[model samples]
Target: MASDTTNGTRTIKITGKEAMLKNKSYFKTSTGDEAGCAPKKGVVTSKIKGKVYYTAWSMDVKFEGENVVRHMDLMTHNHASMPGNTPTWPYLDEMAVSKEEGPCKDDIKKEKEACKEFTPHKADGPSPCPPDGKPSTKDEADAYADKTAAKECLRARRCQLSPYAPTGKQPGCCPGQTGHHVVEAGSFYNVGRGGSNSTAIEGTANYNADKAPCICVEGCNQYHGTHGLMHTYQSTAALNSGATTQALPLEGGKQTSVVSLTYKQAKTFGVDAVGKSFPESKCEPACLEAQLDAYHNKQGIDDSTQCRSIATGYKGDEAEKAANAAVVARSSRLAAASASAPSGR
Candidate 1:
């Protein structure tokens, strides 16, 4: 049994089964009156040995005409109230009481008028402030001029290699030529001469007046001849000597400026040349060796002797053919061994 002595005057006893059931109607008035029942106020409970026990109360209340029951926690002061039969029965008394006085009508009207006086006005037109101006420095002006000139050049399909001239050079103009030429070999022919036709070729090279072999021997063929002819000659030389594209420094502080190609480019050129010169797939080993040499040369590796030996041992397509033959021989041997082996009955 649990006893709720909330007001210290009225005591309501609730059994263990009733507490378990928690029937809210048990606390209502049994007389069937118009106002709903009011349960004992602030009924605090605890559970001991699986049975609910009433402990204490925080609020005091009397069962009146239309008041509903409310419980408030003694420690936390949290309030809870039961539902009422009338729509506003629980808040009727509070609603009937006078509320705190608000601002008067005249005061409200005066406040609105004051707010209206200070309100911001919308602008009649766009801002009177001017837009930001461009930079005025010489460098900025020059850059803008360059950009405009580049755009003009691009529109005209011209090359803007030098920024000094607004109207840039033509698409295929040589260094000193006004018009495009089919071949630019005039510069290379006057390499070592000191007359009006002379042009300096930069880089270290030994020159002899008698033979005049320095320019060609130093491998400046690209500068001396057309690109297609030079490329063909470079491809042939690389295939002949398993040397990569790297330039080798000779004695007397001079370097051999060799024309170099990437591995894929070298392989393509070699394969094409081999197919034209020899039977189909007959010089594949040489082509592969050339590609390997190009790769090693590009990486600056120093294994020239070993690479040359390997290429020589398996020249042409001998390496690939030998590997295929070995595979076929192994297959035949395996088939023969399997045939001669004893079979289980």
Candidate 2:
């Protein structure tokens, strides 16, 4: 006798012999060709009386003549909710049985070897290095020097400035030694003692200055090297002659919306004529507040819900204008209402 649980609630108790005889109708139909059962030879159905029961089958057993040997669990879809209450095809039960074993040791080793040899695709080509040769401006040279120093600092085993590194006093191996220090302006170390006191130079040396000539170190502070000095002189001459001032193109130029520009870009446009060409460079809320204050003596309306709604609802020039209009309309309405209303006193 065997007891089977269908759908985790109902328990079915029936003998193997009784189940076979009761569900004899399903036995003929349940095969590999008809119901997608694994083995074509075995009887998959287990029923008691007219109702279906669960039967276990195994792959180890094979059929021989009249003596039919069923192996593994012959799982079937339970139609307990159906009107007829007949069990569906024995496909679900077959999935319970495991097929292949886990991957062997050799297979894992081969995967590791393949992964080691694999080269990832690079969309931007080789790694980025700081700008080489001398930069035209002191700003550019300073920028290059900082970037190169940061890169070298990152490559070293220990970086004093890095938050991830161990805290407290620690010596670093990089040149321009003043213990381990982060590369930045105003960082100084003792050079020599003068008049019974120590003299300190407020700068560090550029480690890869030859390879990366734009790297401005302590020595290049006065002129940022010969190339930088030449560029500085040339830039000054150009500026004096109005050569540096580039007029915005009036026609046959690309038209882009100003709303796409960042807050800083918009602010730059407001302050500098160079950004005036971009029509879409409208200022955000803070700038809008300043504009409202200047035009209407209003400061609080820019950050209000109504103003924000109007701003977001419209785009580009329309957004700024609409927001301003809404603020004005609201203020007018409030003023008119206050004037008409009777005094409470």
Candidate 3:
């Protein structure tokens, strides 16, 4: 279970009277179709009995004043509170620790080959966005693309995630590429560096579900696939089920929502992402050069200095200027070397 490591212990508490669980965002119908559970008043009732209990561990808990924003204990949501028991005050319940929030030793052991290849891509690592993950400006949004890039504001530090490797590793890239958060990290589920076991931020749940959205990606989702064509980590199928929301924006003022992926479904989609390939569109000279430069610091990986420039569709920035100049200089050096070499007969 992901824990609050602030002082190094989960600051356990009896959920106060007002703590209310949000509707189960994603669920399976009796026939097993992915679907969403909505709150009638505030509580979500299971339709399929033992099969459709809300993903208690994957939901947010709201209290009168002590609202929790992170994921809850992972389990079969089979337990039911007493009829008169509101699950609030009077009689109370303790918050469950984060379920299998991210990859565990067993998980790692299961996917060792994929684990060995895990590398933190620049785009997938920490960025300048705030802990809430809501960027006030477009620059903070996604400077690489334009307004509304669907990539999750993957700002959690590996240290922050403690044991989890920032949502099943994909080891590579940024700007042109992005980290797609499988379980919607849009709001509180998306920010703050609080320990999974403690509330680092007052009045807010500790930010610890590195394993909650443990699912690798709600990817290959073509909901708004045309927005930026920026996501390359997945492309297995079209998301036709689960809860959908236009959580983030994209280039050209377009937007897209995240489709929920269950643990089993996530496994089916291959959390390792080992077999995925870069988007065919992103393999162009400029995109490739920028990606290579980001991955290996080889701006001159190819003779192209236009990596950043083209990747952002010509969005000018100071880094782009310097990068372009460096590429140009390298190109010149290569030309001079060619001229000095003896020609073949």
Tens digits of per-residue lDDT for model 3, 100-206: 33212222222222222222212122432223333333333322222112222221111011111332222222323234432122222212223342222111133
For model 1, residues 84-173, the per-residue Cα lDDT tens digits are: 110111111122234222212222223223322221111122221113222244333223222221221111211111111112111121
lDDT of 3: 0.24
Between which residue pairs do clashes occur in model 2? 57-71, 57-72, 57-73, 58-71, 58-72, 75-93, 258-280, 258-281, 259-280
lDDT of 2 by residue, 256-289 (tens): 1111212223222222211121111221323222
Model 3: per-residue Cα lDDT at residue 40: 26
Where model 3 places Cα greater than 4 Å from the true spot, the runs are 1-60, 69-233, 239-345
What overall lDDT goes with each candidate model? 0.24, 0.24, 0.24
Each prediction's TM-score versus the true structure: 0.15, 0.13, 0.20
Preferred candidate (TM-score higher): 1 or 3? 3
